[model samples]
Target: MERLFGRAWLVLGHESQVLAPGDFLTTRMGREPVIVVRHVDGSIQVLVNRCAHRGSRVCEGPRGHARQLVCPYHGWTYATDGTLCALPLAEGYDRSPIGVEELGLRRVPRVETYRGFIFASLAPDGPSLLEFLGPLRASFDDLVERAPAGEVEVAGGVFKHAYRGNWKLVLENHNDGVHPAFVHASSIWAARNGAPWDVWEKTGLWVARYGHSWMGDYHDDTRLVAALDHPVFREYRAALERRLGPERTARVLGELRWNSLVYPSCSFMSQFRQLRIIHPIAVDRTVVHAYSFRLKGAPQQMFRDTIAFANVVNGTASPVLTDDLEVYERVQDALTASRNEWVELGRGHGGDVPDRDGTLRGRTGTSEIHIRNQLAAWLEYLDMGGPEGRADAPAMAPQSAQRSEAPRQSRNAPRPA
Candidate 1:
């Protein structure tokens, strides 16, 4: 775990989450407790959430705004920049070899933000965020460009939940469309009952550079969107048309390419306007944190839809996602069986075509290309080192066992509104 995570660039939080001075959000960068805070001057800082004096957490909540972080154990204080600013007794420290400056909250070493997304690295040196993200950058582009003003703000609030499973299990599941028909049979019975067939026919998978992969639509299915007939959605569509023109607006909002997972920690599906974080709590447990976004300059109802879509798809009690969580726990339990050795990554094997960027996309959506791609990345990180050591691998594209099959049509008819 340390080798896989401790040396990589991980997301701390979004810039919008802590927009105001002193606004802070607590999160886990791997197993380490981290605080993403904004200072009065507007600079962002990521501080380790431990007190220099007694090793207690200076900031003890999930989120809060504070002038400074004061240790609950002692009076030692730190500025929003993580600079040690105060101590209860100066004379006591004068006798010690360390100065107050030496005792400031430890910074995460390398902190950077790209397009309002904040990330930190524990290792001192590695690829820049640009190199690390590579083609996955398009996901952010598709997300932000959906806004008429070309921007998005984290709105509504965050939804946090967890499942009893390995962290990789969630990442694999994010793009594993073959399971919805079985695992999620009850929840999506009306639409996705025969998931391998239904989802396979509708969703095509794309693998991008740096192990980032996503599922795009094989055919236009606007029923889910058109059914969202509300004053807010109408206004939002009109606003998008004014900025993006009619054809483009339809392509952007009407056809959603959902479940874009940026390897290691986060996934954002712009069509749904939702972002989810996969935090590894242990070898067998994972916490998922989700947030909804409001495209700046879009209709207010659009933000409401973002929340509604997330609730149905990934809410704490989501009718859809809860089914997956239960299966993940059960799968984690089932793996303990003596006969279990390896899980299948052979779905739709060999259906991938080169994406021309050292990555490949599946000819069929049901292909295990996405899962195998991520596991390849995981092995690379755990063995070869993170992004820094990935360049030496065989184009970093692990080809599935050679085979080919045409997609089957979905058996279930579209559900009525």
Candidate 2:
């Protein structure tokens, strides 16, 4: 765990989560709890969730608009900006300064926002979010740029679920396209019970640089492609054709389905209109948060289609996801056996092509290239030393109750990117 935390990229929330003044949310970095808040002055701040007074936590709620964060332990109150505000029954000591600044919440060392998402680094130095995003940034821009409104937000409440497997398994599965045909046989059968085989085979899947991948031509269900295709999907293709010309649009649209593993934690299924975040809980447990977004300015049917897609592919009860989860859990269980020294990542090992960027890519769905890339990043982050070094192991477990406000200092700090 120390090795894992040492070089871990402790990125938490994006800037859009705290859009309004007093809007705040709590997230964890490793085992440390962090509170991100939009201050009264309209600035965003990230702080530790621990209270300065009596070492008790400040806020206990998950999220809410609050002018002040009042600690329930000793009645210590703090302004939204993390300034220590009021303590009950003041005026006991005249010789000392007990003002807000003195007791202000502990602030994260470095905070940066990229593309409206906020990130903090516990370490004073590391790659910026843009640098960290690397090849994944282009994929994110492509998704948002396709939107006529050129913006996206977390639309509905997030769906939080737990996986009884190593977090890495879930991360690897995000871009693993090979499992769909075999593991998702039920879904594929249901999707094509009355449809044609050629159309199903025509649906293209693509793997991108640095573990980012997607499937394309999803609408080629023979039924839909036999028609003119949905107007919105048609418009999306047409606009791309106009911008990049017919040949390029054919190349781009014919390739790629999901845009996932945006480095470190986040994975986006652009076509499904949902993003899934992988949060590590322990050696054998992971908490996944799935967020669906309403594409701003998109047709209502588009959002509905996205929800339906989510239900079919990403829902907890979906045949595809259920089988995948079973495999992951079994893998975790098997790895604990005495025989296996390391999980094999040897598939499609040397076949990766070096792109213009420094990242590597493998062509086939059978490749474990994405898993290799993720482990590479994970190893790099864990070597840098982190919260696990503290005398007291950070509370990596989930708190039974939600916490609202926390001290800016003494909380877990962000790790390098």
Candidate 3:
């Protein structure tokens, strides 16, 4: 876990989260607490959340705007840039050799941003942010390009859901096309008022270069939404095309799908009209943050429509998510008692082909390629330290659950060119 944290770029917060100086938000990089702050100069900084003095955490609330951070335990204070500003009693340390430089909040080694998404890496020498993102870069482009200026901000607040299951379960479920029909049947039934499943035969799964994947329909199915009385999707597509041009618009809204899992940290799903961040609290527990936003040049009604859909499908206590949580917990529980070593990744597993662009395309809607991709990515990250260290141990298995399974698929998820 430590090696994984050290080796990978971790998303701390969006640039919009800290628009003003002294603006800061607290989050975790692996298990360590981290703070993302905007300095007085408008530059962003990410620092380890702990106070250098006595190792107590400096930032307390989830987010705040303060001239300086003051540790509650003692009077130690630091500037927004994390420079040690003051210690309540200077005489206590007069004879000692300790200096202000060493006491400043520790900065995360490698911090970088793409569009407005800020990410940090604890290890200094690994891949740059762009290098790490690889083919998954297009998804980020697709996201921010939805706005007129080709940018986006974190808006509409965060929708957080907590569940008792291994974080891997959520990863597996993100692009698991098969489970949606079965797991979300009641929710879909209610949404469509008990109509039979609208599973589209035209749908497919995509696996991108770095394990980013999703399952979505080939195009908007007007019949699926006709009963909902929401005819806005057509006009929305028209609006996007008019504003972004046919090619750019196609890149942004043309695909018309959901669950673009951006590797280990985030998933952007337009089907629910939100970007989700998956935070692993422990092996057996996870928290999901769902942020819904509006496009800058788009109509106000568009934002409202998106949020309305999100409220129905991904909102807290959502029928769809509620069902998903129940099943995740059930799986976790069953795994605790099962004698089986490897769970199945066999459902519609092998009908994948590679595209000319090097993406893996799964022929079946219910293919397990996405789960298989994520599991492999997870293991590859865990093996960063090589065979001599923690990699040799079966730490990927949660103490409360049984062993996990991962396989390989060569095709990749597509991002707009």
Residue 231 lDDT in candidate 2: 72
The TM-score-based order of candidates, best leading, equals 1, 3, 2
Which prediction has more favorable lDDT, 2 or 3? 3
Best by lDDT: 1
The lDDT, on a scale of 0 to 1, for candidate 1 is 0.75
In the range 1-417, model 1's lDDT, one tens digit per residue, is 575677777877778889899999998889789899998899888888988877998888789999988888978878998888777766675464234555888888889987888888887787788877776776777788788887888888889888889988877888877777777778666665343476575576877644678887733334645686656667777877889899988777655577888888888786777888889998899999888888999877677767888889878878888888898999899998998666766776656676644556776787877776776566556645664564554433333212111111110111111
Over 4 Å off, model 1: 95-101, 190-199, 218-234, 245-251, 390-417
Who is ahead in TM-score, 1 or 2?
Answer: 1
lDDT of 2 by residue, 1-417 (tens): 434432344446555678888888887666667788999898888878888877777766667778888888978788887777788766765633256464777887777765555667666554555655665665666555444455667665666778788787876776655566677777778876333445434433333322344434554332453275667677655555555677755554443455467555677765556777777788899887777776566566667777777776677777777888888898888888997655676676666555545544454445666666555444333433432234343442233112211211111223223
Which model, 1 or 3, shows the larger TM-score?
A: 1
* Per-prediction tally of clashes: 0, 26, 8
Q: TM-score of the candidate numbered 1?
A: 0.87
lDDT of 3 by residue, 151-182 (tens): 56767777889889877787688776667668
Best by TM-score: 1
User: lDDT per prediction?
Assistant: 0.75, 0.62, 0.71
